[model samples]
Target chain A: MKVLVIGAAGMVGRKLTAALLAAGQVGGQPIESLMLADIVAPETPAASLPIDTIATDLSEPGSAASLLQARPDLIFHLAAIVSGEAEADFEKGYRINLDGTRHLFEAIRLSAQLYRPRVVFTSSIAVFGEPLPAVIGDSQDHTPLTSYGTQKAICELLLADYSRRGFLDGVGIRLPTIAVRPGKPNKAASGFFSGIIREPLAGMEAILPVDDSVRHWFASPRAAVGFLLHAAQMDTAPLGQRRNLTMPGLSVTVAEQIAALRRVAGPAATQLIRRQPDEVIAKIVAGWPQAFDAQRASALGFRAETSFDEIIRIHIEDELPPVQP
Target chain B: MKVLVIGAAGMVGRKLTAALLAAGQVGGQPIESLMLADIVAPETPAASLPIDTIATDLSEPGSAASLLQARPDLIFHLAAIVSGEAEADFEKGYRINLDGTRHLFEAIRLSAQLYRPRVVFTSSIAVFGEPLPAVIGDSQDHTPLTSYGTQKAICELLLADYSRRGFLDGVGIRLPTIAVRPGKPNKAASGFFSGIIREPLAGMEAILPVDDSVRHWFASPRAAVGFLLHAAQMDTAPLGQRRNLTMPGLSVTVAEQIAALRRVAGPAATQLIRRQPDEVIAKIVAGWPQAFDAQRASALGFRAETSFDEIIRIHIEDELPPVQP
Candidate 1:
């Protein structure tokens, strides 16, 4: 089986690529070749198998077709502009997020009639907006409050339609906010959710923008990758016409996150979180879903950390250096 | 206020235009001018107010910008190819339904910074698909099974996002299947819902493709226009981030429809109906929404007929020649 990973330079993308390389095979079929695409060519990782890294901007009209020429059997599309950037620059956001995804789907449809590959698209929980129930159900309407969310929702609809039309076998997984995201903070409005945890864990001061009572959903990077793999290998027959699924995640308040961080790294790490209420970030976070009844995805075997303590532990194990005696 | 009607040639568009002309005002504001646009130029209606009919394909670049040159205060975007056509011709469907609508919205966004038009977009209940509740709520997740439904659902997302961003004041009303639809039967799979009553009323036989137990939601063309007009004039303040609404409609089974036809025009009219189960259409209709909990729309003051008898009377009153005693 051949594999393709778009946006393979991002944090999650890099992690996913490394995991795929380690696995050697997906659903028991050995991966023959791998193609990694991003806005900038990804760093070549140590792998025994044949791998190709290409710098490509998917927003460009012919870019998707160029990537499709390899006809990888399984494609993981994780490309997207963050929420803040998307909201700030409307044209750029739509061009990259909406138009780019459409181009990819259209290219797949126009490819040889017999070429139907499994497409695993990463959607976001941003698809849900304000006036949300405390626990959003799998059947909640998509009333996106931001351009980024809107673009994701549109792509999900297109994925279902294209799949129903026999253009491709597609599954859209709406991932929860990735907690303890590795690396430096970015422009996503949800960045602080990770920043407070990641920065503190790295023994650096981090801004706590929202109130301790502010709650949101989360999943570890490993869990997210697990979701991607499950989606790629799962029986799409159960998905039927509704190809999108909201992955299960832990729901935690800011205070609960702090408690978990303290439990894992002591009060010293918790002290690094400075309570500086940023109204803008607070407002954005307020509209986000606190939890979800991801019954469908859960029923289909997707899993996540049951507690924030487990989440923090997973982060430490995955990203932190081992403590010496 | 100056007004623009995008699909001025269609049945609902024509009726909406006629209603606007007859009223000579909207929301108590005297009509200054009217611009009608379609793929084919609509026939000019006699009116003292200035009106322009332009033939243009909105899918073509710059076409939308040309239409926005007038900067009409109110815009009625009632344009879209019917379901069967959109299902058959995927490219044409996306071009006209999705890209065209986006072009129009983008044009509005790019128009004068201060010139925000009241955009009343006609969406369809087809946005909902199966595994559906017997009575779908306004919050039902959009899992459209068809290309046309997918396009509509995507447009609805775009509409909400644009409205939230303050680019335009938009309202998307998801219209129920228009029953007792005017003129000749078209290829829409839902055409029989009207045909059973329409063709029979005109002394012609009509095909009933599904069982009498089959149930669906509906509204008259006149009611649809009312919904459009109401959507145009209603205070959008209450809508906030969620600008799209599922308009209220009467839900009745085919048996009730036949019974209503019998009550209205006796057994003679009911006998004109022929039962010829069309597997293709039956399957398509089967996936459609049977009813809706359009409480939000109703609370917002949009109204529809309560009974099929009333719906049949509406068709007789609006489309048929006056009865000569």
Candidate 2:
């Protein structure tokens, strides 16, 4: 199967690329070739198959069409401006997140009469907002609080419509907030969720923006990649007209996350988390979902780490160097 | 208040225009001027105030900007292609329903730094689709089965986000199917819902394409106009970031409709209804919401007819000549 990975330079994109390369096959079909695309050209990774990387801005009218020229059998669309950036710059957010995704879908629709590639899009839990039930069900309304979330929700609607029309085989997975994100902290309001875990594990002090009582949904990067792969190969017949699925995730409070870190790395790591509160981030996080009854995704064979301890362990095993005896 | 009514030529638009002129004021504000626009110029209404009609297509670049040049104090955005046409033509649907609406919102946002207008947008119950409960709640997930519903759902998201951003004071009302629609029957799949009542009242045969047991939500043209005016003038503080609402409507089965017709206009009017099930329309209607718990709209003072008999009577009062006893 020929595969195309958009936004292949970002952290999750890079990890997904690595996982795809390692798997060598999807749905039992051997990976014949690969194409990686992003605004900045993705780094060339070691692969036995023919691999190509290109820098392309999807917001540009013809860019999506150009990307579809090769007509890869499977397309993983992970490109998006982060939530913070999207909310900060409204036009840029809609231009890239909304228009860019539409361009991609349109390009696919007009690609050819018979070409129906499997398209897996990564949505976000930001699609749900406040006044939410403790355990949000799969059928919860999209009351996105931010422009970024609105863009995602709109795209999810488009994905479903396009899939129903048979223009492409599409599956949109609304990923939970990825915790223990491997890298330096970013400007995303939800960044602290990862920073508090990753920084401490790396023996550095991290600021706790919200109180211990603040709770949010989470999944590790490893689990996210697994979701993308499963979405690509899954039987879409059962999905029918509803192409999007809210991914399964662990629900944990900030206190639970800290407790898990303490259990995994002892008192030193837990002590590294400082109790400096940031109201802006806290208010933003307040609108987010604490948990979800993502029954649809779970029933479709997608799974995530069940506990904060497992999430912490995954972060350590994946990102940190092994401890010497 | 200077008012701009886009799509002022449609049935509901004409009714709203008439109502606006009769009131001569909105929210205790005296009439200043009126501007009506549509793809084809809306017919000039006999109003005492200064009223201008213009031909415009909102999807075209700069059209929305031109419309907002005067910066109307209140805007009624009631333009859209019907569901059947939108379902038939994908590109046209997105262009008019989605991009057109976005263009309008963007125009308002970019009009001036401090200028914000009350934008009353007419959404539709089509935003909700099947796998539905007997009575869908205000927080139902948007699972639009048709391209039309998808477009409406996307616009609702945009409306809320833009409103939250303070670009515009927007309110989206998800109108139930407008029953007893006047004039010749159009090609809309839901047209028969109105045709059965309208044709029978006019002493003509009307086809009932779905089974009598098939239920759906409905409101009258007058009620829809009321909802729009209320949405434009009501205190939006209670809405907060959740700016869109499913307007209240009576839910009734086709059997109830016929029964109401018999009660209102005798068995003669009911006998004009012919039962000829069209599987195509039946399948389409089956995917629609049968009822809704529109608590938010109800609490906000938007009301609709409580019974199908009342609905039929409304059609007779609004469209037919007065009967002398």
Candidate 3:
């Protein structure tokens, strides 16, 4: 099996690439070659297998086609502009998020003579909007409020159609908010879900924008990578016509997240959190979905951390250095 | 109010154009001018107001842009390839159904320096797929099973996003199967919904490809035109972020339709129906939605016939020449 990872320079994309290289195989087939693509050329990690890194924009005409010259058997489409950036720049958002994804799918169609690659696409929970029910179910419709979410939802629909038409084998997984996201805080309104946990663990103060009563769904970065790998190897027969799915995740309030953080890193780490209110962020977050009954994905063997504590532990084990005496 | 109809040659488009011309105003604004566009030039109907008919394909580059040059106050984007045709020709489907819609939207955005036209787009019930509940609701997710359905669903999402961003005042109405269609029968899988009634009423035998037990949702050609007109004038403030709506439609089985036909046109007219099952069409219609709880559209003043008898009467009153003794 050969593999291609789009957006390989991003955090999840890099982690997924490393994991794939370490495993050296997918669905019991040894990976013979790998292609890592992003807007910026990714750093080449030392791997026994053949690997190529390319800096390219999928939205540009023929760019996607060039990347698929090898026609890698397993393709992970993880590239996207985050929600904040997408909202701020509408043209760029649609260009990269919507047109770019379509370009890639069309490229796959052009490439597929007999070889149909397994395409694992990363969708987002933002595909849903409010006037939402207490808990969103698998059957809930997509009414995306943001440009980014709408783009993801459109891609999911396109993927299903392309898959049904036998152009490619597609699986779309709508990821939960990733708690304890590594690196610096970004512009995402939901960034606080990770900031409070990540900043505190790193001995830095983080602002809590909303009230403790505010609840949300979450999974860790490690679990997200796991989802990609599983989707790549899973039997698509069960998916039928509806190929997109909301992934299972831990549902917790701000207070509960704090409690879990206290348990994981002691009271000292918890105290680093500060209370502040921003109506703009709160209003935006209010429209977001808090929990979902992702029964379809769960029934298909996709799993994530059941509790925020496990999520924190995974982040510490994978991202943080060992504690010094 | 200046208006432009993108698919002015189609049945609903023609009806909608006639309704608009008759009223001479929309939302209390006097009709100023009208531009009618389609793949073929629509016959110039007798109207007091200024009207122009042009032969154009929206999928062709610059066609949508040319229509927008007038910057009409209201735009009816009703162009699309029907289901059977879309499934048969994949590229044509995407080009006309998806890309053409996007081009119109992008043109709207470009034209929105000061003028933002009210865009009333026609969507369809095919957006819902099987593994469906007994009754679908307005909040039901779009899980399109066919290429045409998928294209419509994607357009709905785009319309919402564009509306939210203030690029255009857009409303997408997902019309149910239009029953009692006038003129010749088309190749749509759901064509039987109309053919079974239209052909029989015209003294022609219509094929019944499925059993009478199969139930489906419907609205009349007049009602569909009404929905479009209402959407054009309604205060979009109530719609908020969700601009697309499932129009209220009558839910009835084939047996009920036949009974209604008997009541309206007598046994002689009903007897014109022939039973000849085509496995292909039956399979396609089987996956379609049976009924919907379109509470939103109803509350918003969009109305449809309650009984199939009323529907049959509507066909007689609207389409047929007076009963000749």
The chain B TM-scores of all candidates, as shown, are: 0.98, 0.98, 0.97
Compute the DockQ of candidate 3. Answer: 0.93
**Which lDDT tens digits does candidate 3 get at residues A166-262?**
9999999999998778999987788888999999999999999999999999998999999999999999999998899999998999999999999
Candidate 3 lDDT (Cα, 0 to 1): 0.92
TM-score of chain B of 1: 0.98
Worst lDDT run of 10 residues, candidate 3 chain B, spans B182-191
**Candidate 2 local lDDT, A1-325, one digit each (tens):** 8999999999999999999999999999999999999999999999899999999999998999999988999999999998878988999999999999999999999989999999999999999999899999989999998889999999999999999999999999999999889989878788889998899888899999899999999999999999999998999998988999999999999999999988988999989999898999889888789999999889989999999899888888988898898
The lDDT for every candidate, in the order shown, is 0.93, 0.93, 0.92
The CA lDDT at A319 in model 3 is 89
- Give the lowest summed-lDDT range of ten residues in model 2 chain A: A183-192
lDDT for residue A168 in candidate 3, whole number 0-100: 94
Per-residue C-alpha lDDT of model 1 across residues B69-155, encoded as one tens digit per residue: 988999999999988889999999999999999999999998888988999999998898889999998788998877888999999
Worst 10 residues of 2 chain B by lDDT: B180-189
Q: Please identify model 2 stretches exceeding 4 Å from their true place.
A: none
